[model samples]
Target: MDRAVQRTDHDAIASKLSAVKRGYYEDEYLELFCPRFEPRLPLINIGTWCRVRAIDQAITEFLEKNTEGKTQVISLGAGSDTRPFHLLPKHPNLVYYEIDFPTQVRKKAAIVRRHLSQKVELCDSATPVTLEGDINTSRYHLLGQDLRQLSLPDLDESVPTLIISECCLCYLAPESSHLVLEYFASRVAHLSIVLYEPIGLDDEFGRVMAENLMMRGLCLPTFQKFSTLDSQTSRLRELGLTHTISAKDMEQYYNDLPSAEQKRIHRLEFLDEVEEMNLLLRHYCVVFAGK
Candidate 1:
């Protein structure tokens, strides 16, 4: 296994921290994951803002429509994600499960024990926190399990579950990614899965993006296979899996946001790389699939 892939977690957190620092969004918990973050490029911050807010939109829509009073959110390869911190307390009926590598999980445990005790209610307050790769609380569960060898622990199959695969599963082979989706599609009935990944990799801009990542020992296997929004949607409907699927590029996502929000974000920074940013946004997309 290429452990270098796990280092992407740092990028995820740092980019988000950059966005937060620039006031593109509000994420108090993200700083706790990576305390010291040098601000990233304005372009990077804008992209991060769009990527995160787009995903947040998908998750928000899922939560609003499926207000069944009992909901479960499973984040695959959830590395230092602060969604649970913002969501768990707000939505009392929601239970969040974050699955990631053992080392990453334990890293989060150290921080959670040190800072999160006052906010999250522990599952068993009497039990001491160990060095193991698992954290249990009333509203959140951080599991130390590899997605390549995924054996889920105690999932309520009947709950209206929303699975988030944000830039994680693309590291795997296309077949492996499909298997991960199939695994969940088979288990949950009222299931919705949202994905944030790079697409349109066949283009010149996309090629440059791929080369840039490759220089850092990273590979996105779904680059060519699901390179377009249609392919991304088709992959979700593969094996007769999901019923409804919506796919949109980051540019479209930004346009879809309320005009006031777009104006507010523009005020945060001077975006001199509008053309470059649009190209980068075109190469990436956000997808939603529900069954």
Candidate 2:
């Protein structure tokens, strides 16, 4: 299961790469993380775009609102995501952290050192570095730690932080996923966690999606556990993020965007399967919380 989860990272990067190549969004540093590439299905590209769009919206909102002091963005189970690179330079006071399995972290570290070593200015702060524990750069710490047993000594509760789980925590056992959220909510005073996961597992669309994933050795333990947008937000509330919470499915997300922006994305892809796109979008939702 661990290995299967790791392979999803590759699929994620490939999907992103395909979208970028198709001009869905602009990312100067994204191609550095993708080693393998192939034209993916339009459904896959559409799903990838929704995932990035929702998470990016949550992140931009968090940083814009918390502009007073040093802020941090932590990506849980971050795999080949180039967000830190894109965000760090734009927000000078921002510190970005990526946590994943040890093997994944090591792989990412090598890529960072080889391709982007000189591109990003390393953080000069003394707050410990987490690049496989061998490097010390607070600006971008790449920690290789399992979310099931995550431990961080440098997290400052006083500073506002955003945690992102883009189709990440869904892979864990439902109880473990709750524990991971509880661990952070208990430690961080001002926090918001954004989650993107498939819901409505009792529906036929979900059952077929589950079967398709199962054939590829991928499974979402939380699909049935937190089966709806309400349940996703409820998990955040149960974990103590009771202040502000919101949930939106991807179709709603796209509709909520500026009309011009929505049209821009629509023009990028000739999605003939409009019904399929709508069906897929309804099954996945973004559940966010602020505290």
Best candidate, TM-score-wise?
Answer: 1
**Which segments of candidate 1 are over 4 A away from where they belong?**
122-131, 239-242
Q: Give me candidate 1's TM-score against the actual structure.
A: 0.94
- Clashing residue pairs in candidate 2 (N, C-alpha, C atoms within 3 angstroms): none
In order of listing, the candidates' clash counts read: 1, 0
Residue-level lDDT tens digits of model 2 in 40-116: 77777877888898899889999888888799888999988999878887898788889999899888888787777
Poorest 10 consecutive residues of model 1 by lDDT?
121-130
Residue 13 deviation, candidate 1, in Å? 0.7
- Can you write out model 1's per-residue Cα lDDT over 1-291, one digit (the tens) per residue? 367789999998999999999999888888889989889988889889888887787789888987877899999989999888788778878889999989998998878877875665534466555555588765678898878778875788988998998888878888888888888888888889888988988878888888888999888887767888888888778745456556789888877879999899899989999888888788778889887
lDDT of each: 0.83, 0.84
Clashes of 1: 1
Superposed Cα deviation of residue 249, candidate 2 (Å): 0.9
